[model samples]
Target chain A: MRRTRPPSPTSAGPATREGRRTWGTRTAAPTAGIATFEAGGWRLEAVGYSLRPAAHTEPPMKTRAVLSAIGPDRPGLVAKITDFLLARGGNVEDSRMAVLGGDFAVILLFSVDSAGFETIMRDRERLAAETDLALVLRRTEARAPQDEARLLWQVKAVALDHPGIVHRLSEALAQRGINIVEFESHVAPAPVSGTPVFSMEAAISVPASVRAADLRAALARIGDEECVDIDVRPDA
Target chain B: MRRTRPPSPTSAGPATREGRRTWGTRTAAPTAGIATFEAGGWRLEAVGYSLRPAAHTEPPMKTRAVLSAIGPDRPGLVAKITDFLLARGGNVEDSRMAVLGGDFAVILLFSVDSAGFETIMRDRERLAAETDLALVLRRTEARAPQDEARLLWQVKAVALDHPGIVHRLSEALAQRGINIVEFESHVAPAPVSGTPVFSMEAAISVPASVRAADLRAALARIGDEECVDIDVRPDA
Candidate 1:
């Protein structure tokens, strides 16, 4: 039998108030049949059973929060947001942040226990007032994990600058029941002439029944209709 | 029959003493079977055909060159490099540049025809001397279109501050023939007491036949051995 040690008391609590509620409970003992090891400088453990109870089998958390902060771009955007989460007892598990058009835009996904979640939501006005910024919060459900064995395709489009290119292309994919797993867009000056150019790349999951050729044809048609060049290639 | 446009007239000119070349051509009438569109201010065209042998596939042209300059960090790095490339009829295509540890590093991929390519290389010594920086130049080969799809996976490892965490984890992935697409790492100060912590996020490609679970397990084992925490998630 493998011996499991309790979580280190020194471990910092979750940064979000909700996270504190969800993960704050003490375990009676490390569950049996699990393994634990220490390698790089962290405590490593694997729970053989699901972390959440089967009866509760609540869906995975998928909520999107849009964070907008306008001020002099400084070195502490990350530090400030992190400090906020820590103060609220929340942990930011996933996030994308960047400076765009002179403003810092942050989109983050996080989870918290139901306890105190409402209170934090109500304090949005306070956060904005104190930080001199605006914040919008929305609840999002977690997406179902795609089958690991399914074939995936990459679609890329480039054209003279235009807006809503992503929206139109994504709508086409949605009509085909293709699930977009990832997407990114940028406007860059052309290498040779300095002409403004826009490019978008997307990774889409394709079910077994979908034919690559057919998908390509569909994209080609859409490209023609939209006057944008599109290419569909097999994603490794 | 499709009217194939002859190769660019300027592109095929004789190489100079310095081994530079130039090519200039105009687009031909659009093929009836092909599709073309404008997106994000750039024109994109797609033509489909079965692979076929050409009586003469032009020998790879050394039209492009990569110029790198390294020195103390400062502004004007972009301006200097751009001036050089533009003066010699070259154009910047794609680049990843950053300043690390107070040292400025610039890597640029750019293109030019043979005529002007030699002039650029011949002036390489003068460039280094004038800029007060080390300079390296390499003739570039024609780029084959990339048809393979790329998937990005974000992997993070947090362990006790150590020297070889990256090396150990990267070596395991290399042993499995995995290719790392991009990576960023930082040493974060622990929240409560400011204990040093090491964390790395790498974008990697997963080849067919390599299960995500298997990779996760391998990383878990490494984490256990090193006493670190590891998480592998899709970059969506």
Candidate 2:
């Protein structure tokens, strides 16, 4: 669920007290040829009637990137990558790594100044060759604010190991214009029988127009056809 | 969200077709004096009615542990810790790490055989001493399956930077017997005013009896009192 918060004291009280909550729509004449207005949802008034040259400093405009690396498991693999990033002034913001089979796979979100990012782009090939990693890098931005009408939901499914489960399920959501935000899956043995069981979990965003009951019924139908146990509910 | 799935073909079909879904409830006499029953939600039958010595192989009864380490940032830190774990037959299951200020902080989930776990416990002190790290380790287990009626929800809040935001918010939740599963927060400059805005997001599990409307109203009151914008939604 996405909804704008009701006005809070720190943000809205002062303007409301002035009997005008609108920005840049004032009908009254400016007291000093300077109009009071809001920018980026923050109230701003020309500090002091006399304006001086603004501070020369600019806010840090950091650029972010997503990096995925998969390589043979070996000592110093993580060190190599992290060391390189540190040397380039890149800061890791978030990361997840795991060992699967005999290989190590990692995904990292990092930010760097623009020039440092350029350097990373130039040197990525050399580092990949040295580390023997299959590397994928893509520039990314912070997620935009969510639309207030979108609904978030979670879905979980379990079944005997089978193929096309993700494809079939995702296709239905895609047809309905739903977006999958995060998904994870694993295969494990049934505690007693040692038979492989597949399980999946995903977070999705449903448009405001979709009916939850209709979506649940659709998923129940798919559960019957695919022999899967599917559960869908609003995501916390 | 945690409801046990309705009967599916592969797991439930066989038993249902036999006209008895209840395990070990048959009244008829067994032809071979063997009682068939479900174990761990699986169907199993004695093979060939033979009682020969069963295979001696044991399923891997792996144990899990959580490790948290923080140390001065330097080259090869990850390598040093991971190399030690690999040498001890430990497998990295999940990991998250980042550099906060000038210190590298990491939390890892790993699994090992019981003996190997004991070995790690014994050597952890030496590792911490040698690496100049603050290390904490605790045994963990896979989360038990969720109860069917528990409600999973997500909460997010943004407010002018202030003390006690988390404390006050969580206190309300704790009073309601809600459990926090995951939480993260950060402070960043407001886009225009450069005011430090504190933002938080959390995933929580509410008891079955908690009404969603009541929870929302409670959060709304907190938002008003704390001068924060709070959004609560059923999580997907």
Candidate 3:
């Protein structure tokens, strides 16, 4: 999440008020179902859970599936979903789940062998009915070993909010044989004038055959034609 | 797509032969069905699509739902999905549909009145079977009116990749009555030594009653305790 600043100090959130310290100082008490570390009695709370230690097992096949769901934001949603996946021998490798507005939206990628993945597929309807989760799963091939040749670069562009910025820019990169790894764009009002500004940042791959200069030149052309400012820098 | 540089330049890709410029110089040809503007023959390709002009109608309550599916990437996947939604009087508001790996992944939010939404819910099972697309429909509340008192800020933190980073930090924010509006985190290699680094960026809302300094202090403590580096910035 990236943002500029508010105009006034009050707009940044009311000045620190010493009198209104609302949080309870429940000293030395561990919240239910939560573990706390009492290091040196500093009242420092760990406030979290840790995974149980795992026993030795053969490294499993690296099959993957992309899973996504959206449901009313309610307690136990994550547990309900993760529990089902665990019970089915699917292990979540990575996930990006958030409450977009009031709805609980999630997109997860889990590892599961072919048979186990098919089992999840067959039960998709049942899972939806039972968990009250609107779910979709895509079986994916095992992750490939890392490619050691692609150079990475970061690019940022800003301009008046307009349609086609993403499509045009992405198309331009594609034409240059550059692959966009991560890209995010947002529009926010300009601080003083309140004009909406569209800004984008992308992590891209530059093939060794494609000079960074060539990619930068192409982006510059797109920027000139589209009336946006763009910058590309090597990833740190 | 976020990759380190490949080992061999030849293996990276075909050498940049100065000649293979593929995007057409089709001076002003409308690209098939997509709308195009032929202004002064500058070939300024009007870079996008616009909604079809609409006839006057009563302002409808914008009921929304998220629909997602994954199937072997094939032709007409979007058309098939959108046709179904359009047939049901639903208008696609926003969507993130892409071909990830070999499968087509789509997540869409569409608008319809409550009754029309219910019709789609009841038809969810049928939709899945008919289109061979695992479809899920979730009803979401209309967007809440903006709260002027909610101050926005961004927080970024990085540490060694560990299991509880997200849970612990999120719990801390929730305890302070903060709302995380947007968050994305990833575990990537540290450039120099290649140690895995867990980095998070969150856009949060602090009520007018909460002081930004206090919030920052608490986050700083979390960072110290968790061995992370954190930065928070306000958004205007």
Best by lDDT: 2
Q: What tens digits encode model 1's per-residue C-alpha lDDT throughout B22-114?
A: 223222427775444322223233343222223355433436555544544333444455566667766555443433333334444455668
Distance (Å) between predicted and true CA of A223, model 2?
A: 1.7
lDDT of 1 by residue, A1-236 (tens): 01122234324323222232123343334557544333223233344322323233443332323232332222334445545544553444444343332233344434444443554577767766655444545444443454545677888888765434444565556555665554455557788988667676766767766677778887887688767888889887
Comparing candidate 1 with candidate 3, which one achieves the higher lDDT? 3
Candidate 3 lDDT over residue span B41-102, tens digit each: 21222233231212342334557677767665443455456666666767554444544445
lDDT of 2 by residue, B16-67 (tens): 4445344322223345754444333433343332222124534346776767
User: With candidate 2 superimposed using the best TM-score fit, by how many Å does residue A123's alpha carbon deviate from the native?
Assistant: 1.3
Error of 1 at B128 (Å): 56
Question: Which of the predicted structures, 1 or 2, would earn the higher DockQ when compared with the native?
Answer: 2
TM-scores, all models, native as reference: 0.39, 0.42, 0.51
Each model's lDDT comes to 0.52, 0.62, 0.60
- Steric clashes per prediction: 48, 11, 8
Model 2 misplacement above 4 A: A1-54, A142-148, B1-236
Sort by TM-score, top down from the best: 3, 2, 1
> What digit string (tens of lDDT, one per residue) describes model 2 on residues A1-236?
01122223343322444353443322333577554443333333432323122246343467777666665544345556766776776755555454433444555556677887889989999889987876766566555555648888999998875544555676677667676554445556789888767677777778887899988988898899989999999987
Model 1, position A158, has a per-residue lDDT of 83
Summing lDDT over every window of 10 consecutive residues in candidate 2 chain A, give the lowest-scoring window: A1-10
* Model 1 stretches astray by more than 4 angstroms: A1-75, A144-151, A207-209, A223-229, B1-236
List fnat, each candidate.
Answer: 0.00, 0.00, 0.11
Better of 1 and 3 by DockQ: 3
